[model samples]
Target chain A: MNLIAFAILALLAATAVTVARMRDLWAAIMFTGIYSFLSASWMLILDAPDVAFTEAAVGAGIATVLMLSTLALTGKEERATTRSPLIPLLVVTVTGGALIYGTLDMPHFGDPSDPIHLYPNPSFVEKSQEDMHGLPNVVTAILASYRGYDTLGETTVVLTAGIAVILILRRDESHPEQQESP
Target chain B: MSIEQVVGLYNYWIVVFLMMTGFYIVIARTNLIKSIIGLNIFQTSVFLLYITMGRINGGTAPIIPAVVADAHAHAHPADAHATDGPAGHSLHETADELIYSNPLPSVLMLTAIVVGIATTALALALIVRIREEYGTVEEDEILELDRYS
Candidate 1:
């Protein structure tokens, strides 16, 4: 299991690097899809199949399509920039180093004694069984029932994003000539 | 570090590396669309981090098996001895034996994944509009055009 996890992480890292370096927007978007698919596989390894399903559907599927359509409307190749990369490189290195340091005290991967497994009084798994009356999927019970308001808020966010997209992209029919490319 | 320590912590280190790569792309790259791609990468790495934290060594997915759930449902109304037959007793035993990975993170990440996609879609729409108005998606050129105007 560790070996498989390592391999997937390696592939994920490779894809991220490739996406960062690629000049062609289309190729970069394709590589991003591959990265998302690999992330879904890793989530499955971590025992989060619900999250894996969502990541595969939303991340790899919808996001990739959106990016490709955006690419079609924009330039295919990124123009070469004269700006120096040293500052951004330095900033990222510092932030990453701090995050790695923060992980030192984190529980070992998959340690059952971790606080997340034993917290909030009965934990979500046991509580869901009681509150949800033997619901087969604890994650769904938590999302749709126990945490209903949170889900409702997320739905509202999605709705707002859709409306914002429509407002931004919809052509003005009253002035047809204004719709022409400048 | 020892092998065990290295094994325990390497996952987090790699995730951080992936995140930094994305951050570098977002900050250093000139293209607006590439920045959005970088943002997606950054978001995904954070999702992986949360899911990684929720794993249990021997745990299965957080979904209860159908037979076990059926046994639970049956056992709820009456005492196990009164409600369960021989097969149901075994299913009850199996349910007691099962260990599930943390469902809270899975629940949170599910919502996050949907929100991330929505954010991506909105950003892409903005990028398309920016392209239509400015005739280029490169950040530096857009700023130069603004400066001259």
Candidate 2:
């Protein structure tokens, strides 16, 4: 509708195309940062300032920087001729499409009259004194108290990934490579 | 329909298309950095999804002014008159003033973004060590040496 939104959409599309066609890995990494910034702009246009902030900081800022760092350690040239991955592509396409289609049955974007409002959350704001949790933000209360178990699971996932990374990149102190004297 | 609904809707579709394609690249391709790029796309699409969900119809920026903030103040039972209509109107105004927003997904998204950054950082660190150990970072090179080892 607005110029800003149009610019963001254009940039988003261009970044996707560039990322796809990019031969150099570092250029693709740079475009990933551009893509993230455009996505954050779209988020801001959608009226979620908090989400916009996080997307800009984490998605564009930290994530892009780290990815580029990895690229620096690795070679920039992508494989010249990779094998055709038809089967995996088909599987991923089907699964992702089904999920996107399923999201269509969800409430329209930003509809004021949605099931989200019909939840017990309104009661928390209605009777703040009655809420046993002292948190002012209902979302925090729900995440930390009501759905505490799910958060614990997420923490465990992070822990598992950390352990896996350590194992994958473990040191070779016992078997040092033989060096020749100059 | 407003232009927001018309053009804005397609914006979501583009994100989804790019996202799925990028994810396909990650899952199908063997290159580590390519997989990371694909993961970036996947994460960006989710941010789009959350931001789209948070957009409110007929809603202005959420900054609250001190005077206008009083509009949301609720009246206790003691302050109520013996009339039901005025009480009902007061209650309606209070609820309406504090517009119902689903902040849960957005809050969760914030945590997700942080976790995404952490993962990326850890992944990069691993790649550095992987390069040191293997003398190369390409998947084919690593696999070639791995097969022989």
Candidate 3:
């Protein structure tokens, strides 16, 4: 099990590096899809089946398609960037070092006595076990019932985004000069 | 560090590396679509981080025993008393067998994933419009055109 996890992590790292270096937008898009697939598999190995499903469907499926459609409208290969990468590289290094430092204080992987599981999670589980709501999938129960308002807000965001996209794209089609989009 | 601590911390380190890779791509890439890809990568790394945190060693998926399922299967419409006793007892019994994974992070990620796709779609749509007006999606190129005109 540990070996499988390690292999997946290694593969994920390799793919991210490849995606970063690849200049062909389409190839990078494909690699990003592969990256999502690998991450979804890792999510399953981590016992998060719901998140795995979402990652597969949304990340690999929908996000890839959206990116492809955008690619059809844009240049296939990126023009060489003129800006020196030194500044961004330095920024990433410092930010990543800070994040790693923060993780040093976090609960170790799968530590049973972690305070997260000690308090809030168990309370949520207890709520799931309540007689009024005997939900089998605790994730679904929390998403739909306990945190229904938050999910509702997310849905509203989705709705707003869809409207904004339609409004933006629809204006182009109506333009006399812009007859069709490739 | 000991082997145990390394094993515990390695997952987090991998997550941070992926996050930085995505962040660098967004910062360095000039193409709008590539930046969006970088944004997707950044969001995905976050999802992975959450799911990784929720996993418990030897824990199964977070699915509780279905009390209603058991009740319906055993109750013959006349065994109300027998069903009642088991239904109440089953809930308590679940705690004994509850070696299930944490569900909170998974739930949160579900909504995040939906929002991510929606935002990606919107970004792509705007990119398409930009291509129509500016004749390019390269940020520097578009800005250059804007400067001249």
Order of the predicted models by TM-score, top scorer first: 1, 3, 2
Candidate 2 regions with alpha-carbon error over 4 angstroms: A1-3, A85-93, A123-182, B1-12, B60-64, B71-101
Per-residue CA lDDT of model 3 for B1-149, tens digit only, reads 67888888888999999999999999998988889989888999999888888877778778766764355334444432333332223222334455777788899999999998998898899899899888988999889998998
Interface RMSD for candidates 1 onward, in order:
5.3, 5.8, 4.9
lDDT of 1 at A179: 68
Please name the candidate that would achieve the greatest DockQ relative to the true structure.
Answer: 1
- For each candidate, the alpha-carbon lDDT, in order, equals 0.84, 0.65, 0.82
DockQ of each two-chain model: 0.48, 0.35, 0.46
Question: What is the alpha-carbon lDDT of model 2 when measured against the actual structure?
Answer: 0.65
Ranking by lDDT: 1, 3, 2
* Model 1 TM-score, 2 decimals: 0.91
lDDT accuracy of residue B72 in candidate 3: 39
lDDT measured at residue B26 in model 3 versus the true structure, 0 to 100: 98
The prediction achieving the highest TM-score against the true structure is: 1
The best candidate by lDDT is 1
Candidate 3, which segments miss by more than 4 Å at Cα? A121-123, A126-134, A172-182, B65-94
Q: A111, model 1: CA deviation in Å? A: 0.8
